[model samples]
Target: MGQREIRACWFGAGVLVGAMAASLCAMRAMARARADVSADLSPEVSPEVSPAALPVEDAARAPSAAPESGADMFEYRGFVVHLFWQALAPARYKAWCDIWEAGAVVQEAGGPPATYPTAAEARMAGGAWARHWIQNNG
Candidate 1:
């Protein structure tokens, strides 16, 4: 190629590289701004009130100021379990043993939350479920 053509090719390559770099920088800045906004919006948990420090019974019985969004809490066999509907998959219910002493067990993703007509019946069923889970998985 002629000297002029070579120079034009190099200039084009440099411009392309510069554009790519500018795009990458812009994306990184946008990500950082999004993170900052999320941090500012989310509720901050107090250092004094760790989850382990809170009693399981109190957590189960306590009224949440937060709106009912398909999440439920239950006390079962001295442990508190939280059953909530996943945001992405609203049809499925996710269960978690909230208390540390319960080993913070997360139920299998597809497992359904135990259902009962009364709290007493729920407690009985929950105790059985806990025992079965511990024996098989723990």
Candidate 2:
């Protein structure tokens, strides 16, 4: 190509690269800001509150004391799907339904825990279950 055409191509490529870089920087800034806001909103736990200091019953009841084999539970609309260990084949994680009243369990559903392979999958199912429960039981 001629010098003028080569310059034009380079200018176009430079503009495209610049635009992409700008967009990426903007996305990162937005993500950082969102993380900061979330950190500010969440209550910070004091380091002094060690698990060993709590009673056995209280430790068992604590959400953070969930078994290492189990994933974290998901909550929605005052309902929670607690994660539990499942030895069953084809499922890695299981969830039990519980009603949360004023941040404490008010009711526990009778039935087997729902099983899923991943925590994210279980969370999605938990959200659906919460929605269904709200519609029918609310």
* Winning candidate number (TM-score): 2
What are the lDDT figures for the candidates, one per model? 0.44, 0.50
TM-score of 1: 0.31
**Candidate 2 local lDDT, 1-138, one digit each (tens):** 899999878877875885596567546645654554345332333334555676675443333322213323566666564433322343355544555545444445422346777544655565566556655665
Off by over 4 Å in 1: 44-138
Positional deviation of residue 119's Cα in model 1 after best superposition, in angstroms: 56
Per candidate, the number of residue pairs that clash is: 0, 0
The prediction achieving the highest lDDT against the true structure is 2
lDDT of 2 at 74: 64
